[model samples]
Target: MYSGIGDHGERAAFLDARALIGCRHRLLLDSTHPRVLTGVSEDAGVQQRREAAAAHRMLVRDTLVAADPERWLVIAPEQTAAQRAAETMAAMEAGIERIWGGLLPQELDTGRRGGCEILRRDPDRGGYVPIIVVNHKVTDPRQPDPADFHPLTTELYTWNPKPDKHVRNRPQPRDQQRLAHLYRMLQRHGYASPALVGGAIGYHFDRVLLHDLGPILDDYDRRYADRIAVVRGELPTVPSKVPECRQCPWWSRAPEEGGQSCEQWLVGRRDISLVAPGSRAEVLRRHGVETIDDLAAWEGDDPDDWQYEPFTEAIVTARAWATGAPLVRRVDRVQVTRADVEVDVDLESYQEHGAYLWGTLLDGVYRGFVTWDPLPTRDEGRSFAEFWSWLMEIRAQAAADGKTFAAYCYSRTAEDKWLYESARRFAGMPGIPTEREIQRFVDSPQWVDMFQAVSEQFICPNGKGLKKIAPVAGFSWRDPEAGGEASMSWYRLAVAYEGGEPDLSQRTRILEYNEDDVLATQVLRDWMTDRADAEVPAISDFGRRSIAE
Candidate 1:
């Protein structure tokens, strides 16, 4: 059988024995194995167990080799195979221990570096063989105490019965006799004995034999039984005035004797007000305030207010003092309106491979755009330098007009930053605008009108995100269809490329996709403006308010 041991040295020995002499029959021992102490202390003890298991495995192989040079043995260290060996050994050890306690001797050194002895005979000769003693060092040396082991049998049964009740309730004479006979047999055999005598007879026997038996076994006299004891008591009975009796804890108290009137004795105690606000005597007060009638009559919001209302602790305490309970108040709902604006942006590459992205603001009544590309090529001559100067002039004009520069996604802006930084470092040129200036340009209030218009009209059911709601807002694209036609977005196109045939070049496809997106944004803005005019009356109201304010 395959045995998993932590002792690598012992494992090597086992392998050597199998290789040198063909000994197929083997008794795999993993006495101080790490697996045996699963969930044990993680310090030195666990490490020690692992090392010991490995060492023992190798030692077994060596012992086998020394005992029989001609015998051949094979040991597999695979997890599943090793686990099977461990399980078999565990079951056998459990059976032996349960029946015969300390009769089996345990290994002296149970730590990681400890050794264990294994006995096995040769298959061909069938005679006494040399015992294999294997030692494997622990990787970690600390071990835990035995008391930490979790118990197996608790909360097994309920409703233990008394002996007198058991005798009175047994419907069948034969069953009662059988139980008595079993009890007598248990008295003869020791309770620790694994002979199955106590389990065979007694109340358990009745449960096995009779399917209809209710709490007879559970209610039987448990004190005299050899097994665990149980407690049994009668179920409580309800009185005629059930509701009143259920609420009264003293319902089980003894009744007062006649002639000596209980009325006299209960007079001062009858009105023992348990409802006092704060005192030891509060629980004994019994002022009549059961229904809401008493509460409404009392002054202040405390008595009239509902106790379950959600209020501040201070409010609750004040209410309780004033009226002895919580007070409820009406809650108002706050309305918030949200809006979004999608701006069409263009990115122009002045140098062959260098580019700068820009944003075009589309307000309901105005169309203003900003361009900010700088010349990266030093050899491009005066035309490129002039173009760069013109772009910077346009940016200054936009800033003067209160317009903000914004990117479709922050990652796009980050890419621009990286490119700018690299050019400054490699080409010995100054970095474009500082990040603070870029942020200021992106967050200007000049685009507020456009933002409000788009937010109220173009945004989907949810407030944020454009990936899922882009098309729904009338921004159409040529997304690929099932068979293999060109689609609008990269997502749909990628799916088509994967599932169907792809004929277009990657660079061309990307350029086309980006252009389509830019155009869609332009169209979507126009459509959203039209929709606001036709559908949302609140848009005009908001605009008028903004102008007036």
Candidate 2:
């Protein structure tokens, strides 16, 4: 019956179940169709309840008739003193034969064969009919005692409060009225009683209803003893109030003070002042000079007489005053500056093979030795010898001046391979510098200091290799877009060489390209040093501010 009204797919199995039981039955369906069930009735609530009762009655009558056809007349409803009649049914014999009934396909499977056979067969003639009821509704937890045999009803009721009348408009009054009505109905008919009454009551009536209802329900328990039981759903708990209610909007309106609102009180508040260039504000903003800005301003070239403790004291005092909400300390600012220096530089390139020198040239000085090897061999390459000689001369000049000789190549592969191979070839050479000495020469302290100072002063947008330090020193260069006409990669040069002959023209082209690279590097280096000198004050100021922060 459930399958017939619930889903169309189970219709076949439902019919088979009915056939197996050898009895006709009517499906008592719940009419959820709103239009037919709910019409223009003034008391629609009461009418709906009646429909539910009618449906239950029809289902009970049908199930009792199906249990035993011969006993149907004996159990049929008879006329009573009242206008409406009530029905009474006789129980059918059971021990004759038990017939199992279930949705088919599943009940007819091999595992269920025995149960299906029992459902089809008749019971013993003098036995009581066995009743099997299947309900899919969620069971109410607060129900009658499991040991009781009487039927019970569990219902969910809702009530909405109104404003005018506190007594009648509240949830308790309505709930009590509903409960009283149900109790009377149960008393009129000796059928069964409710084991429990449980549901969420409105919050407004909680205090009033709980005080009265909790005791009333408990009294029902005491009176009924084992006959019936009554239980009510638990009320929800409320949270505690926070102590920081002064900052909460729910407490009150805005304050009279002319400042930020309560919501903005947590945000930071500070005052800033703009003064002269060498004033307290400006000096405190220097890169290295933290606290006292003009620590070395009055000392000039003499490093002595510049007490560092006074500057430290000034900084500590200023910070304390600022933290106290109103700043107080102030000082006289003095400006000290450095002069710009220009250094001359030149780029030189050479080509050599084995022990014999081939070609050499200096940037802007075209008239120089340009030797070459007519016979080209892997072991007798002119480029290698020339590179070795050039490196030795550059290192000697760098050592005398206490400066580092930096080489800037176009790409990582080219520069890395040249450095590695040159070091390997000169490992045992008579005039070559050892690996450690060469590394020390490259890592000069003066160069490191200069580079670090300049890098912190400005931004480098087109930074790459040795050119990254250029923009920071206020110098700029024109670097060709990568892979463009002026740009060259080792792979491209190698491809050209692989297809060419070992002639003078090819060697000349290679030498010219290498020389051009050296010249560019020299020009960039000179430009960087000059720019760095001119931008020293700005760089120093930036450095000091960074330290203070």
Candidate 3:
């Protein structure tokens, strides 16, 4: 029925719960997948506990039953992994301390297990005939194979709870081919249209699917030996860290933090993926270079090879890491014009979309972020116009005062990319910065990218990310994890501005994060200016200001 899992930190043979729920490809791929970060997040951890608690209350009692032999089974005789996980937690507010499920090999081999949480059986007979798989994820769970059920069963249904406004129901992907393969079709039914989870409770009846159980039984048998070996700690997994590891639960808990920062380890990882999709980072790894150092060390040995360009790029990346500076190969003294009047900008946005708010620091005075009431998905509303007009007016005044206008930001990639995107998106909006104007503003000498400036001079560990480097620049954040990602989460928690009324608490946090970002640049700028000491390059490409001509 299933593999066995012993109690807390106990070693015993067990099958992973996912192997039962996953498609065949996902099963095989995940089995061999590295332990590094793969799509795990703190928010997701919170949501799972919330959903599991809600689901636990929904399915635990004498729930429902129907005689259709396809849909309803109120009470299940077996406890599922989801239930056990929920029970083991101190409370939903408290985190899921750990994941616990599956049976010992003897009980597991009894042919009654899966990722599903509940198991129901026919009244006249015994054993599990239908499984109600409870998934806490917002998306609907995929349908299971008929063979995974007991020979005595006759039906199965996926029971999931989600946060949809109920405009659409989650369940009812009949998937007849998968259902047909089960070979117990009283009829082919997809139930494709989802009505509502709330409506489902009214129709529960007692019936079960006793489909072909042979394949799953064989699957269990095939996996038993390997399962035992894993329990015995005979298998060691080397993690290949990906971008997802930045927020992964496992990475947070793992003893070793081996990641991109480790050049030697990073360059050697190459894992092919299919069912478990790989980020395919191996394209760079395939070039026979692993770390940034390796790339930097290439002395034009393979001039004719295709890896040259990537190698060249890697040298810059490695040197930047080594020195925390940008443009390592360039010997030019990195300098930008200093003036009495300075403008520093930071934008906050939903990463899935364009900027919602743009904040600026003016002459060391915080001017505040500009955003419209009821944030638009892509429109450059009045607030953007207001912000731009003021910026232009300031630029004019600074020029009139015989002082250069040095506009600043920490990183160009996000702030630079977003401003142009917003400009292009709102090109048709009257009084808004046109796409051309946005480009002109970006190219102007006023726009100084501190990130690029620092990278040219410093090699830093933990990468040259602003949060890490900001402290060195004598800047600090009041919030624990103030980042672009954190701000997005804050945006969700923050109330939207309504009819000129702002949500102060949410607005405050957003502003705080933005201010810290802008100030980090200020610190960096002051440092670079002070460091210039005897010589400052008369001209800098920080922003060419060809537009000023």
**Number of the predicted model whose TM-score against the real structure is largest:** 3
Q: How far is candidate 1 from the true structure (C-alpha RMSD, Å)?
A: 29.9
lDDT scores for all predictions? 0.29, 0.29, 0.46
TM-scores across all candidates? 0.24, 0.25, 0.48
What lDDT would candidate 3 get against the real structure?
0.46
| Model 1 residue 2 distance off true place after TM-score fit, in angstroms | 24
lDDT at residue 481 of model 1 (Cα atoms): 28
lDDT of 1 by residue, 1-549 (tens): 122233443331111111111111111111112243344343332344345445544654554456554433232334353454454234333332111001111111221110112222212332211122223111111233444322111111211121121221223433332333332222232212221111111221121111122233343333122111110111221122112222222233322224212223222232221112212112211234322223223343332233432212222223222332211111121111212433444332321223322323334222212112122333322222333344456556656777643323212443344334333323423324444443464465322232333443321212223332345445655534210112222322332423564334532454444455455555545444444334322212221111113
Instruction: Summing lDDT over every window of 10 consecutive residues in candidate 2, give the lowest-scoring window.
Output: 22-31
RMSD of each: 29.9, 35.8, 14.6
Q: Is candidate 1 or candidate 3 better by lDDT?
A: 3
**lDDT by residue (tens digit), candidate 2, 166-272:** 12222333243223322322233331123222221222112112112333544443332211111001122111112222223322322333533322331122111
lDDT of 3 by residue, 17-86 (tens): 3333223322222333434336544463345344544454354332432324334322232666455433
